[model samples]
Target: MEILPRPFDAQPLDGTSTVPKHVQLRESLRSYIVRSGEPGAAIPSERLLGEYFGVARMTVRQAVDCLVAEEVLERVVGLGTFVARAKVDLHMKMTSYTEEMIRRGMVPDARVLSFEQQGASPLVARELQIEIGQPVVRFRRQLLADGEPMSVDENFIPAHRVVGILDDPPPTSLYSVLSEKYGLVMEWGEDTIEATAASPSIARLLNVEMNAPLLKIQRHAYVARAMIDYSVSYYRADRYKLWVPLQRPGVRSPRAYSSKRLG
Candidate 1:
């Protein structure tokens, strides 16, 4: 494996330049990281960086802090900072995780953490449009991409909708099983996404530290008017990002706007 360049080998920041010292250092470090092209590669300590750059340790920290906030580098407790993996951009769409991962040319897999037939909680019942305390099939799964843990998902379905799911082995793709065996195809879904800290159990399953940043998503998948699946998923913020496209309404081209104004 190619090695990371030493801090002294990096170009010294120009004091006469108009750019801030921290910003200059940040760009220099970013260039080195990109050139290395190695995820999880550990750069030099702040002390070494400060000494080599003839700056204070505080200055070195400022540059590192900026990269950390941008997810370009990650600090591990007692382990130092390492280059972060690029985040997966998930387009806001109506598709299963399996389908999305496959389309991205990554191997997708799921491990059933727990499966049970239990009474639906008020939240689950409301989301599924079923009676409170009704029996529901609950499945907790760990979703993986390229053999790495990506998210933890808890799903609930009304027991009457798919009677024999408990008897059959837990499925890697719940949507596939629902569509093929029960004829319940998910036509649409409503998603609520938010930023949250990882709980202890969630942290363990996703292999992240407790209180780490995570993306929490609650979804209601429906087959026409009937709600089929109610699920809550927690994804690692470092590894996943939601992508959305926006268009401004009633916008006209520059030439059209000019012509309209003249007319």
Candidate 2:
């Protein structure tokens, strides 16, 4: 992997240049990070960077602040600034959280927050195509990656279909268990994603500040036209991104399109 070039080695800022000093410094730092090829690597101290660049400490701070705001870097209270992890890109597909993280080379973990059989709410009933007040198994869990919180997922399944699932340990992949134990293979699903603010409880659970931006995903999974899973997940916007591929009508194949866009 390449290492970051020393700040002093960067090209000197020209006094007569049209670009602002802070912007120049920010670009330089960004280049250094890209060349370094190190995610979560600590950056040089602001004071040292200022001295190396012959700029005021405030100017150096401004440069670093820009990178932090753009999520190219992150600041830890006492640990200093470091390169931010690449956000997980979730493409439009039916997949389990475990499968998604594994594809990204990250270890996935889950902490069950709550699990119980409860009467389905009106909305849940509608989504699952079940009667309101019908018994349903509700499982709420915190999905983690590399020991860091990623999303809060709440899933509801018809209790009758998953007879004694509660008796077993919480699974890393709910879909896997559903298939292996209950012979319910989720073949297709639709997801609706929306931007939302973190509620106080959710903020605490996700380790984000209250009102932080979040991506709320509502999913309905089915097996042979039978609605089996209704899940609502809230993901930290800073750490996750959704990718959807679009094709024009009458396109014979994906390869026939010259340009595919992500939404």
Candidate 3:
């Protein structure tokens, strides 16, 4: 959670003022959140809030309770309160998994589970723009973030471009490696998202209950004239949410909502 400086122009609460000091403090904080695009953010602790607002800790607790009841913030069992990640706008162009993790201020990581040459099936061949039964580089990983297990990533790259990568698996950002080593800087990709029941593997890796609904992302990434990667990502629905923003070119844009979808 981030804390900006308290504003100086805040009108001090007087005994005769109808609004309570705690309420006024909360309102000021709420406005700061809106302007900073950090709504639902976990603010400072109750003691710190009380100190900043010149109010009692109980008064600060009252304001926090009100906000929590309204679902503006959430408290984890062991972790402190944090911004409730609720928004899921589907219309916007999808970003890379690594990119999304970085945006949320988390360090995304991956463990190479397996890497080897694989024979492409008809469907895989079509997706990678290769012939069936051709040798393709298959790279699989147990994706991680902040040292915790995330979804699994199964990706395929053309064998010719990423030679010997399967033999000498490296521990680093694949995107950065592709850009510097293979000169394959992916510019864009198309992803198809769907709701699917979690597979046994997914349930195990994501630590989710059996048969839980999960978001499946199937993507085909391209670079230069060849297909760079075809990846299938299964995100843990309970621990994850997707947020996107959409707008039309040369047109006035309307407000996008911050809520989750059933899918």
Candidate 4:
């Protein structure tokens, strides 16, 4: 009988006859998903995957458990198990949504809710290198997973740089276009996070209940030293937990951190 292989992202390269063949096979497939950057992407169905790998469904489930324990995949109560998108080390840098998703082992996709050029608001103008009331291109995107709402990102671009804009770029990542088409590279960023009650507008966009606490992260992104973009993000708090692991130089091995509850 065949079984799924292990999933530590470091499966043995040589044959593992001593171990279960299913474990070896699962390790190989798990490696593929990690390297392929589809961490949370929906995997092929168990029946299909079993047939393709010449394994039994039970064996496939065992392999999936290993990935889940590694935090490489997750299973929603109703939704099937998928690659998880949990980041262990939080890096403060200007990174594209797609890159961030891949790091967490989640399959990333984006939908443009709205995109157009508009006059810059006083707040936006001050953040970017532009004058108040200057032309700016604004866009709103509903970032998704296999098909679940995860976050809503809003961006404002200087109008001059946006010679043409697409209401539906239909791309997984926006920075790709900004970098490839406009020669703009995301250099650095500062983010401030807070918990807030969902306003009516936010509730509508995020499909959350009023007064529900939402994770809001405001960012000011720069290209080198110049501030070129600002974004307001509302994330489903239940879906994401931000972690920042600290390491003192010359310190001992890393230890797990547990959030403390205050009375």
Highest-scoring model, TM-score: 1
Off by over 4 Å in 1: 1-25, 53-66, 76-79, 249-263
Per-prediction tally of clashes: 0, 0, 0, 11
- Every candidate's lDDT: 0.88, 0.88, 0.69, 0.72
Please say which candidate is ahead in lDDT: 3 or 4: 4
What clash count does candidate 1 reach?
Answer: 0
Give each model a TM-score: 0.78, 0.78, 0.60, 0.58
Which regions in candidate 2 have their CA more than 4 angstroms from the true location? Answer: 1-24, 35-51, 55-71, 74-82, 253-263
Question: How high a TM-score does candidate 3 get?
Answer: 0.60
Clashing pairs in 2: none
RMSD of each: 5.6, 5.7, 9.6, 11.7
Output the TM-score of candidate 4: 0.58
* Cα error, candidate 2, residue 105 (Å): 0.4
Ranking by lDDT: 1, 2, 4, 3
Residue-wise lDDT of candidate 2 within 16-79, one digit each (tens)? 8899999999998888788763887888788778877889999999999999999899997777
**Window of ten residues with lowest summed lDDT in model 1:** 1-10
